[model samples]
Target: MANDPIQQFEISKILPLEALGTDISFTNSSLFMVLTVGVSAAFLIMTTSGRGLIPSRLQSISEMCYEFVADLLRSSAGSEGMKFFPLVFSLFVFILMANLFGMFPYFFTVTSHIIVTAALALLVIGLVLVYGFWKNGFGFLKLFVPSGVPAVLIPLIVLIEVMSFISRPISLSVRLFANVLAGHITLKVFAGFIPMLSKLGFVGVVGALLPLGFTVALTALEFLVAFLQAYVFAILTCMYLNDAIHPSH
Candidate 1:
């Protein structure tokens, strides 16, 4: 059990409870998610509460994150997309915090689960669908119809476009889920090797150092991946919202 890499991802009940014959027990994942939200909110609030002209480190970080998402929204969806800044920023920070929190020992990675990622993906897609229709009416269907296409190929292109649009949530959720799940599994497997190698003779001690160094490097890389994944998720959301704002193409 000690060497089982997959065991770390297991969700065990911390406080069991039942409601209407359904299990609503709190688990490690729930705990970490709550922690993620609380910590993220507190950090932003506390850092910016002073409203200083000359920014401190934490204040700079808050301002940078604000500008980053704002610029990303503008670039992807144009000035009109700034209206959705709150939604996009919230998701970016939440996912970023969740991913970073999971990097710590014994912490549950909420984004690693398909259920969580899928829920988030569905929320974005659902909003896109609702707003697309509400804002553009039946004209939203034009999103699947490309301009200047050959008459004969229009039907085929529409079918492909429809399929691609429907697959967005699946692809988005799976991308994050797979990356976090695989990364943690790989890190755990390599980590398991260090103790095993150290138990051997002199050669084993030297061998252990190799895995230790590699593990450290991988951890750093994972941090980069964590941030990138969050950015990708947020940017993709902006692009999808763009389709809602301008469905002509």
Candidate 2:
């Protein structure tokens, strides 16, 4: 029924197509992803297309978002990290737009999927590795070795650092996927309660009010979470980039 929480997460093919023995069909997730990127791009362009000494509301919102991510990168990775503004800004805008789009009824949440989140996290880590090696050469190996450790503990510390480094993508992906998945599921559950409670006449209708209120409150909170998750992801990306830019401490 409409109350089934997991039903919201179902990925259905929109235009079934296969190539090279693989299911390369277009899907609802793909649709929303396109929509997310398109809408986000348009919003930025429309808002900032015309410059003004005194900004309009839309321009102000766009500038705020730009500064927010820029400040975050500058603070976390230093002014040297400004070179990565395009990457970090793109990630933040994509995630924030995808999440907000998912908030609408009948929309698919892309970031709620582990595969999508994992891909994004892997991209960040992969870039870090490539840049770190390219910029620092073999000296990037110092990232796993602290300067002050004793010879005896160096081996053990290096082992721990290696493990932690390997786990970055896993942790980053799971953090985003889990939060989005759990929040949506919880929202659905509470929302489902309203219809069920309303089936029992007067008392049922009154009880349904509670769930309705909760649903509204949860929806509001989810909006905040959507922005926050994007912010956290961007900031974390900056920190990882910092490691790449200055690998040795």
Candidate 3:
């Protein structure tokens, strides 16, 4: 039914393609992902192309994004983390744009799918692992062994740290995927009520006011959530990168 809130997440293939016995079709989700990348890249490139001293509104936004992610990285990982600014910044922009795009009717939310968020989470963690070992060598193992602890509990602590490190991607991906999925579903469910009640003439229309109010409020909240989730993901990425940079610290 048109009122089905969960239907918003449906992924349909736009162009059917197959290769090596695998379905590699272009999908609505894929389109939105591409659109998100294209739009964000274009906006940032064009807005900052002028390099104006007195920045235009678009340029100001672009600058703000750059500075915001930079500050977030520096705060979590210190000056050393600036080297990963491009990765963190791209992630923040991509997630923020993908989330905002979903606000439009009929647009698919790429991050709403666990597969997408999981891949991002894995990428961050993968980098952390590769860099941590490469930079520190076996000294990277120091990450799981805290500096101060009783000898008896050292093994236990290491095990705990190892598990916690292993769970990073799972937590990161679920946090983003779940928040986006729930928020959109709730917004759609409430929004569906607006038209349903209106069909019942004046009395029903009057009754629809409650859900209408809820829908409006939810829309506002979802926008905030979209930004917050991006920030949270980026900050966590910085923290993980910090461990890679200074595993023993």
Highest lDDT scorer: 3
Best by TM-score: 1
List, in order, the clash count of every candidate structure. Answer: 0, 0, 0
For each candidate, what TM-score against the reference? 0.97, 0.96, 0.96
Task: Please write out the lDDT profile of model 2 over residues 1-249, one tens digit for every residue.
Answer: 888999999999999999999998899999999999999999899988888778999999999999999999999899999999999999999999999998998899999999999999999999999999999999999999988999999999999999999999999889888889988999999999998999999999999999999999999999999988888899999999999998876
The residue-by-residue lDDT of candidate 3 on 1-249, one tens digit each, is 988988989999999999999999999999999999999999999999999999999999999999999999999999998999999999999999999999888889999999999999999999999999999999999999999889999999999999999999999999999999999999999899999999999999999999999998999999999999999999999999999999985
Between candidates 2 and 3, the lDDT winner? 3
lDDT of each: 0.95, 0.93, 0.96
Candidate 1 per-residue C-alpha lDDT over 1-249 given as tens digits, one digit per residue, 9 for 90 to 100: 789988988999999989999999999989998999999999999999989999999999999999999999999899998999999999999999999999998888999999999999999999999999999999999999999999999999999999999999999999999999989998998899999999998999999999899899989989999999999999999999999999998
What is the Å distance of residue 10 in model 2 from its true position?
0.8
lDDT of 1: 0.95
Clashing pairs in 3: none
Candidate 2 lDDT score at position 152: 100
Residue pair clashes in candidate 1: none
Residue 122 local lDDT, model 1: 99
Q: Give the range where candidate 3 is weakest over 10 consecutive residues by summed lDDT.
A: 102-111
Candidate 1 has its poorest 10 consecutive residues by lDDT at 1-10
